[model samples]
Target: MKFPISWFIGLRYTRAKRKNHFISFIAIFSMLGIALGVMVLITVLSVMNGFERELRERILGTVPHVIVGERAQGVTDWKSLEQQVLQAPDVVAASPYIDSTAMFKSSYAGTEYGILQGILPEKETKVSVIEDYMISGSLNELVEGEYGVILGAAMARNLGLWRGDKVTVLVVEGSTVSPAGISPRYRRFTIQGIFETKSELDSRVAMIHIADAAKLLRKGDKVSALRIRVHDVLNAYMTSNYLRANLGEDFWVSDWNRSQGPLFRAIQMEKTMMFVLLTLIIAVAAFNIVSTMVMVVTDKQADIAILRTLGASPSTILKIFVVQGSINGVVGTIVGVISGVALATNLPAIVKFFEEKFGVSVVPGDVYFIGFLPSELNAVDVTVITAVALLMSVLATLYPAWRGSRTRPAEALKYE
Candidate 1:
């Protein structure tokens, strides 16, 4: 099989040993640099993607995807409204809840302020995963009229309280007016359960039976909101909008986007900035090919003159050098992608191994939401990185290849 003249010569040039070892060094360096840059970018992006996924599962899992509430007062017709919400597109389950702010004080520890939520244990499971993280007792222990409370692990720790312990809860929202000014409503409740999400919420949230919450708030058969879980959490915002439009202005529809959107958006922005910054490393490495090719053209002046004299067109000369330079990009990109994917996929295991070997924790569970490193390789990320690298390599070759093609045959021969 005969190869094209330009391809054959170009390949020959790539494999040939050059007299100037400096040019050879630069070529090798550029290839390695590109490989390193690509690998790092892939691994970092994968880790970021992993963090995003973890946040969604760990934090968002226990939070409502969407909440439907009355604009004024509480949701008096929540049972019927919940049925209506269930009929909405993408709605998987709906549970009635009462949200209130309160301060909890324990006899053994200090007072802590947190969000106190009221929920029906059975119905709560349909919308949130609170029951899954229980450290002690059960959500079912929160019986109506018992005024039972569920404390977050961190909050429980800070309050030095445990299951079956008594905690005093003070609510300013439902305070009563008295002769000695407004008196804050308060209740003493026994802890029924404790849960840990390993997140900030663990220190900022508490829960009780909806019936108990209703009585404390002086609300009869009314809930603060209808918590809705959707089939796809990513579509929660859209679902909220649909519910808002259908449920009318009298009802307020909110989603995770309102409460947690900023955090995720910040993560995304950081990822983008990191991508742009790291891409510069690859760009610098890719541009190194320009210097490598330039030196190659200079060293091959006599060869170029000879080829031109032998009826090789300037365009053919350009193609030869372009192909030679492109070989470095292709090889580098392939190596980088393979290594990066491998590293990203096994990152968690690798971190675990090192942590075990060193007798140290890279991600502490109590300090961070997760106890181990995580990674999630994305095909789109790999593809984009590959394309960018190849493009940069090809572009870098243009100037040098064009200069080589413009060499004068007569002048080159004279010097040779």
Candidate 2:
């Protein structure tokens, strides 16, 4: 195939052995730097994306998207409120829940503090992923009036409690007045099940039948709140507001954003900061391209002079160097993209392999909310990274190419 003279000569120059070997080394180094930068940036971004996805699907799935309750008292008429909430736009499911802070005392492990949630097993399935994460027993085993509790995996382990074991739950409320003073109410509950979500919730939360919780809290036939799930989780804030307006002034609505928004925001901020920091690596590589082109321009002055004598225009001279520098950018970017995507796609396996090999955990579930590394490569992110790299490459070439183009045939040849 035929090629433009500038392109052909530029490529030939790239392949040619240089008198100054250091220039060739710098050229190679620049390409490798760009490749490494792109690869790392893509992999890190993919991991961040994975974390965000897990948070939305796993953690958010367990927590209510929107919760409605009476501002002054518990929702005594939750069944009626549930029906109303289900009618709201974007709302998909609603379940009555009772919540309280309690201390669980195990015969073997002393005591632990936790947030207890009362849920209707049948209705709970419509709103959360708790059933899917059950490791010991079924949610159906939590019979009404049985005083059975489902403990989170971490919480259970910490308390040395297992299914069928009995634990004492002490609630600070519902004190009994006596001659001496008031006494907190307490109840003994059998452990019916255990669940693991690999999230912080697993260490700080427990569940029981809503009916049992109501009795324990002394709020007969009432619940603390109504948990609602929506079809579009991103629109939960708007849905909460809609519930507040439609449900009247007596009820208050709260969404996941109010309770968990800061954590998600911090993750996003870290991702942005990481991208900015990694881009500097690519910038430094682009600078190397500039330096390489400057040296090339100096070395090829005799050739530029010869070409000008043979009727080559300054524009042609500029095109030659631009094409040469851009080749480094394009090749490096392609390699980086291929390697990055490959690594991101198999990151989980890679992490597992290293973990098994070293006998150590990279992402401990108790600490990081997940036991393993996650990755999800986004096409838009890859495209943006590639475009930025190419732009920097082109920009780096301009100055050296302009300087080369201004070489006068008479002056450049006189020294030779």
Q: CA lDDT of each candidate?
A: 0.92, 0.91
Residue-wise C-alpha lDDT for candidate 1, range 196-283, written one tens digit per residue: 9888888999999998998887778888889899999998998998998999889998999988999999999999999999999889
Give candidate 2's whole-model lDDT.
Answer: 0.91
lDDT at position 405, candidate 1: 100
**Model 2 residue 221 distance off true place after TM-score fit, in angstroms:** 2.5
The best candidate by lDDT is 1
Stretches of candidate 1 off by over 4 Å are none
Q: What TM-score does model 2 achieve against the real structure?
A: 0.92
TM-score of each: 0.97, 0.92
Pick the TM-score winner.
Answer: 1
Model 2 misplaced regions, further than 4 Å: 1-9, 15-17, 309-313, 354-361, 364-367
Span of 10 residues, lowest total lDDT, candidate 1: 365-374
